[model samples]
Target: MGKKFFVAGTDTEIGKTTIACGLLEKANQLRLRTLALKPVAAGAERTAEGARNDDALALMQSASIELSYEQVNPVLFAPPIAPHIAAQQAGKRLTVSQLAGYCRGTLMTPSDFALVEGAGGWRVPLSGRETLAGLAVELQLPVILVIGMKLGCLNHALLTAEAIRRDGLPLVGWVANRVDPDMSCFDENVETLKQFLPAPCLGVVPHLPGASPAALAEHLDISPLGY
Candidate 1:
């Protein structure tokens, strides 16, 4: 059995894939086989083979184990919109049970570390009555939150943490990604999050343009993840 975690972000565009890739890279450094999955994605480009998502492609490249694009991203929509809306446009429905089954089947492959990256924020709608959070609950995976360090991040991070707790899942750790290059009171805000969030800080990633997973891995500590 391998250690698997559900990666969630405080909000969309919060560097969840970047942080998840960094963690996978760091685990690979320790000679651990790694796998990554993006159960649902809203944005994709039409490829000759099929639709491909950039985030899922990046995760596939970062992992030590190779998986087909479809295995990595089981549900994909062409437009960069809310997943539920995109699914509706495609005349498809999204359900937590279906996504969970996809994730569980892929997770059967052996690996030292594996991650299931959520599409957006914790409460992103999958359908009229379903949200992505339900998928995490269905899998019963511990969570690793990615906090986009920026203006108003404190409220977002706190509220997200509260929601995770309310969902009855363990928030094992969090990463602070510096998404805002010029956000005010950055260090102060990180300190406040460390004080309040119900998990240890895995890393604080400074904004670096075009940084590889190997480069970002240098700043992350995976021992907190029990590596």
Candidate 2:
């Protein structure tokens, strides 16, 4: 049983994959085998391998070990929409037990670090009743929240933290990703989050003109994560 962390974003497109890949880059430096899983994804494009998700692909590329796309993302929907809606459109049901079981199996693989990225926000529904948060609790993995720094981010970040605590999940750390380039007082916003969030802010990723996990890893400190 190796170490694992559940990565959840304040909202979708909040750079969760970016932070996860950065962590993987750091883990690689230590020569630790890494595995990343995007349990459910909505947007996908057809390729020779089948429906492909950019986020999952990035994780696969960053991982120290190679895993087929299915292992990286077990549940994928072609349409770019809310995961629950996409599942409904495809006549597929998303359940907490099934997703949690998949993650447990993946963690059992021979790897030093494993990251399981959730589909959407913490409370996003999988089926009509089960939420992603519920799956996190079932797995009992420590969580890392990705905060997309933008207008109203304070509310979103704080609320998500409170919910994670309420569900009894340890918030191991957080990443502050600059999603909005023009957002004013970025430092002040980050300070406010640092002052309020229960866990330490592991990294503050700026809008990268180019995407390089190794470059982004320079800004992150995962030492507190005990990995």
Candidate 3:
């Protein structure tokens, strides 16, 4: 058994993986056994062994210990679109119950934490009737939100925070990832999130040239989980 977190982002490409990397770095620094999971992936490219997705691979790379890629990303789609639609287009089926079942096993293993990064925005559908929110509740884990700092970030962060609250989930903390360098009022936007969110501000991820997990983790904050 281990402490776990559900990582959701304000939007896709909002540095959710970057925040997960930050937490993974901290777990490794503490010498704690840890793993990161992206239960569903929408985009993928060819690898020697069929196909693979970058988001899921990035999280596994950040972990100190190695885990089978399937253990991390249980549901994968080839298209870069909403997972439900992608599943249909790819002639596959995805359900929240299936994801929950896999994650339950992953969470049951011995470790300090398992960070599960959700697909797209917090509300993306995994199936026609179920949402990512339902999966979060099924897992019964606290949430760590990744807010992409850019124009209109305030609205995204606040609305997502509200949804977390509505689901009766504890917002463990949040990370601010600087996605758009030119977005105005970066500091102000961060401050706004810090004030409005029902959780602590874990850390601020500043944008760096040439995307890599190591650099992002350096700035990402992994505070103590109140488990």
Give the Cα error of residue 130 in candidate 3, in Å. Answer: 1.2
Worst 10 residues of 3 by lDDT: 218-227
Q: Give all candidates' CA lDDT scores.
A: 0.94, 0.89, 0.83
Runs of candidate 3 with Cα error greater than 4 angstroms are none
Could you say which candidate leads in lDDT?
1
Candidates arranged by TM-score, highest first: 1, 2, 3
Q: Return the TM-score for each candidate structure.
A: 0.98, 0.97, 0.94
- In model 3, the Cα lDDT at residue 172 comes to 88
Clashing pairs in 3: none
Candidate 3 per-residue lDDT over residues 65-131, each given as its tens digit: 6889888888888889998898888787887788899998877777886888898888998778888
Evaluated against the true structure, the overall lDDT of model 1 is 0.94
lDDT of 2 by residue, 1-227 (tens): 56899999999878889889998998898888999999898899989878899999999999998987888898999998887888999998988898888777777889988899987789998878878888889989899999998999999999999999999989989999999999999999999999998898899999874579999898898888876
RMSD of each candidate? 0.7, 1.1, 1.6
Instruction: Judge candidate 1 at residue 215 and give its lDDT.
Output: 90
Rank list by lDDT: 1, 2, 3
Estimate the lDDT of model 2. 0.89
